[model samples]
Target: MATDPIEQFQISNWIPIEIGGLDFSFSNASAFMVVTAVSASAFLYLTTSSRGLVPGRLQSISEMTYEFIASMLREAAGSKGMRFFPLVFSLFVFILVANLLGVFPYFFTVTSHIIVTFALALLVVGTVIIYGFYKHGFGFLKLFVPEGVPGALVPLVVAIEIVSFLSRPVSLSVRLFANMLAGHITLKVFAGFVTTLSAFGLAGAAGAVLPLAMTIAITALEVLVAFLQAYVFAVLTCMYLNDAVNPSH
Candidate 1:
């Protein structure tokens, strides 16, 4: 029998815990998330610890990643937005590492879950809103009310802007979650096809070639997607931060 493609995403509790009738069990998802965070932090720390005069391969990688995100944030939000460098950098590293880790066999994809991605989206949007209000005071409301709008159309434009702003989190979370989930499922299905077909005989094994090829292709594509999705998330985050910093625009 072919393995179920969806089985890969099933969350299993590793260490069950309950407090005040709440299920707070440590799960496979939790474990991988911890692994992702620790691995990314350790990689960055170890790679950059020496700060060699002439950069080694590891140090070069670390430097490149830093510069990439730094340049991206600077471009998206401007120099003033560099104030949130730590937040934006951390998010990029975390999501990038988590997505890459999920590519490994038996590893749980943390961002594939809607809840996980949603929580991350909420964090970004929440930061934008809180900082927008704090720094700009009521001036942040200008984000929804653009300059040079005629009096009659002002209400309509404001309503549209408000809806679009509110929908950011939903769109952001769903983009990441859906992409990761669909890619993994497709990979799993093709892989299962290869395995099931190979078991029959010489003829079956020959037929398995197509699915095997597809599985390999999808795996490579998924790796690219892992990085792409991370970049997309970080880029959107910077753009949103720009709104907070310069609400009038």
Candidate 2:
């Protein structure tokens, strides 16, 4: 049977089960998220526990991943911001794993779904807001107010700051979802071309070769995109944390 590429994106279904008198339906995206969380935890536990002085290959790789995230956080949020290394590291690895999982031939890439990405974005952005308020109390409200604003322009600048802050999740989620969706769609379309061309005569078969080659190239590019989108997500989280730590004005 021919697969519906559009249908592949569907994530919801009604389940009869109820929890606390509330109906709950399991979703494909939800399953993927659970899998991502478990796999990430198990991976870290297994790799970190088998420690070596110099480090085994797996230990080295896992430590490298940890250092990569720690270094990125330090770079963005600084040493003072280093307190968030655990949060930032988990964010980076979870996202990187989720993104790469989608590149496999049949697995649904949860990150390609806007809702999943949006949820993650909201969590990160929400963390920044909550922590900012917790650490600074009412003074965190000053984040939306530029100190040097003239009396006449203070209201306008504050409004702009609030709007920008609210838009963070929208921008962050859309970037990952859009990039993954577009890359996968383009890849599927090219693969379809290879299929259609193979049915024609020898001349048509010859033309099929180039599309197949392009498909291979696109697959490699998609792998890079997977890694980059994860990096971008982690970095943006760090930037937001920085803003919470020290308001620009």
Candidate 3:
């Protein structure tokens, strides 16, 4: 039987374990997350280990990635925000690699799941909230009050601001999750058509050509989307952190 296209995304337990009525199975999704992290680390390590005077291609890529995040942080969060360089950079690299990995034949796309993306979004927002309160104390509350609002409108504006602030995680997480899920599903559907059509005789083989072309095109587009989604996530993270760093704005 031909494999179901959606079955590619089904999570399977590689090592099942239950403790105190809690299932803590080591799943394929979890495995791929580890793979993504390890691959990213290895890439960074190997690319920068030499530190040659004339940078190799890998070194140049590593350096460019560093500068890109640095520049993004500086622009969004300012000089003091550079303190969170490690945090932002790691998030960027991890998401970017995880996305890129999913482009491969058998890799799982972690960010395609709402739970994973929401957790990441929560991390970003949680960090901002914690740092904001810790750094600015009561002053962090000013984030909800606009500078030019009249006293009469302050209450209404503050309420609106609070709702908008709370929605950040939802927006951020859904954007990434929806994009990855849609892109992958579309690719799988087209690829499956190619396989299904090719199973017939000569006419079927000929019919598979269109879907094959679409599959290739979508594959290339997904690669760009993977990078774009990662960038969007990282940039928004920086912008949120900036609010924590400078809450008055």
Candidate 4:
């Protein structure tokens, strides 16, 4: 199992802890999550702390990210959506940083796990449901009942909408988890091919060329997937929050 492609994802406890019979051990996954959060926070803080008149590269990147999320939220949920800007921006940065960090060798991809992604998905859904009811009261239920549905078909449409709404967390979590898991597994398998073949001497080294190229190509693709997944998660979040802000249809 030492060289298994899936072995890279195995969690190892660095500091095992048991509290009231509950396992709360600090494992590799937890450590990487902490690292991701700190790295992202520190980068944004340091880069923009200067408030430069003429922006540097890091500062420019930070500002672009801010504007990107701002524009996305505004477009999806309108001016009212700006209220959730801090939450949306934080989630976007956190997931983006975590995904990118996982692209490096020996880094753990926390987003690859269903549990982590599901928890994040739940948070967004929870916020939507809570805010929807709080802001609009019973009017939030209007989200499930389309405006133009015939009276007889309203029941069927409402049932379908309810099912779809309930499935958001499932779909959101699986999309990120599956993408990260599959990409990493494919990359690892090709990488292992490169290593195993190189050990077989000159003939095998020459034969390893294809797998080596594939490994590189997949690595580049994974980097793009990392960014894309984060953006997708963030944009979907904006749309969901829009339902809470304007639950008309």
Point to the candidate with the largest lDDT.
Answer: 4
Instruction: List the global CA lDDT of all models.
Output: 0.94, 0.84, 0.93, 0.95
lDDT of 1: 0.94
lDDT tens digits, residue span 1-249, model 3 = 344667767899999989999988999999999999999999999999999889999999999999999999999999999999999999999999989999887788888889999999999999999999999999999999989998999999999999999999999999999998899889988999988898998999999999999999999999999999999999999999999999989
Instruction: Give candidate 3's TM-score.
Output: 0.97
Per-model clash counts, in order, read 0, 0, 0, 0
lDDT of 2 by residue, 1-249 (tens): 233456556667534567998857676677877788898888888988967788888888898988888888888888878888888888788888887887887767888888878988998998888888888887888889888779999999989999999999999999999999998888877877887898898888899999899999999999999999999999999999987787554
**Model 2: residues >4 Å from true position, as ranges?**
1-4, 12-23
Decide which is better by lDDT, 3 or 4: 4
> Between 2 and 3, whose lDDT is larger?
3
| Candidate 3 residue-wise lDDT at 105 | 77
- Is 2 or 4 the stronger prediction by lDDT? 4
Candidate 4 residue lDDT tens string, 1-249: 645989888999999999999989999999999999999989999999999999999999999999999999999999998999999999999899989999998899999999999999999999999999999999999999999888999999999999999999999999999999999999999999988998999999999999999999999999999999999999999999999999995
lDDT of 1 at 131: 98
In model 1, the runs with Cα more than 4 Å from the true position are: none
In Å, residue 184's CA in model 1 sits off its true spot by: 0.2
TM-score per candidate = 0.98, 0.89, 0.97, 0.98
Q: Candidate 3: count the clashes.
A: 0
